[model samples]
Target: MDLGPGRRAVPPRFVLPDVSEKNREGKRTARERLVVEREKQKAAERRRRALIVGASVVCVLALAAVVGVLAANSGKDKKSASDGPAVAPSGATGKDGLAIPVGKDTAKSSLTVWEDFRCPACKIFETTYRPTLHELVGAGKLKIDYHLVTIIDDGRGGSGSRQAANAAACAQDAGKFTAYHDVLYDNQPDETVDSFADDSKLIELAGKVDGLDTPAFRKCVKDGTHNSWVVKSNAAFDSGGFKGTPTVLFGGKNLAADPTMTPAKLKQMVEAANKG
Candidate 1:
């Protein structure tokens, strides 16, 4: 050390430790790696969210499709039901399976009727003479046979006559033949509207009859179980050498031969036939 009176003492130089380039580069690389990892994680999170959204959309569409299919099937079932016929009354018997017999089979005098359900004239005849026939039959004077014909169907554009006859046969099976027969006349649709072709309407009419409309009855009607029988009956009617409907026969004699025959005259004819 030198004396310090006229000269400043020399100070020692202090040096800091130098950082290595490789170490700095390594720190920078580490920070960059962290940033890149964060970006990759963000990208992965976005992709995951998108996939979740897509899957949810697919599920919703699938649910909608299922609902649509169910609705379509339901509508188809109803439409199917609306496109058929009525059931025949149970245990209804006839000659050659053509005519459904009414009243006492053992009665002395017999009356046979050939009719079409959709015939307006037939409807009038039914409305007028049904009660009278019932009265005679109740008195053990006559038995009746009903032959269902479909001439009206052949002429009319729809299956009204056939369907109505078929349904009447079904009612015959259900023991409500008379009731349904009257109902058909009462609800006849202007002879031009073939509403009876709609089996749903026929079933609705069956509901009006007591102990007539039932599940089995509906099934029978819808299935057209007696359609073939009705066909056979109509064929028989044709083979019987008859052209028009509402053909009335008493003891194999044509009673409706007179075009202007009144209901009272009709009763009188039956009474005369019974006495003979």
Candidate 2:
């Protein structure tokens, strides 16, 4: 056991720590955490994209629903007589036998209405809602020029419109056009066969309305002198872009349909038109 001072016994052999299992486990845990974080980020991105797409789809559907609803409710209410432009009852027609109003003509308003005499809605417009517009006309707030279209061909084998036109023309000649106009609407038949074609019946109807020279009106109707005017009116109706009876022109604006054709809506449109 005696050793030199500078010499030292040989050191014992050192052994390395066995850490392979622990390192492997730690590596596995780190890899799993990384995978989990990546999965979470991917899921979040997918949810965000889905939300944006869903919102866009909902907006499109909402707009479509609104349009559909408006279309569905378009024809619900009939326009009242109080919702039209004005015209005076002055300025009578010729004294032959045609009826016309002779009054002081008013200033021109921006609204014009085109109508067919045989149209049911036109009759309703005259009888029910015309007074309001008449008052405006009388007050110089509205101007209504009646462009009479004959659509009787659609219903009465083409003769009804012709007869009515003849009668109207006669009324125009006698300066009783408006009076005769009212009479025709009052005596409108069921629009069926053999109803509006009878000449005798038309003569009888002529006899009922006052202010029309019976003899002249009868002769005018028999002679067909007023037929051309009716034909012209029908032709002009096409120029005005009318596709059917009861088509109305408001401030020169055309419409296939208006969901808001009532008095209130009409008033609004008129106001807007005036401003423009």
TM-score of each: 0.65, 0.54
Per-residue C-alpha lDDT of model 1 across residues 1-276, encoded as one tens digit per residue? 111111111111111112466576654553464355345435644565666777788878799888988777874543233224423345555666567888887677887888888765566467656777788888887888888877666654567777777788778877788888888889988655779989999999998899989887788778667776677777788788874567887767665555445456666766786677
Superposing all C-alpha atoms, what RMSD in Å does each candidate have to the true structure? Answer: 42.4, 36.6
What lDDT would each prediction earn against the true structure? 0.67, 0.52
Candidate 2 local Cα displacement, residue 60, angstroms? 50
The CA lDDT at 152 in model 2 is 49
Report model 2's TM-score to 2 decimal places. Answer: 0.54
**What's the CA error at residue 246 for candidate 1, in Å?**
0.9
Off by over 4 Å in 1: 1-94
Off by over 4 Å in 2: 1-105, 154-156, 254-256, 264-276
Candidate with top TM-score is 1
lDDT of 2 by residue, 1-276 (tens): 011111111111111122477576664554464355345435644565666777688879799888997678764522111123222123423222122332235444445455555554456455534555555556665555555555545333446666676667667667776567777778777544434455566777777667675787777676555555555556666675565555555655542145334444554554454455
Error of 2 at 210 (Å): 2.2
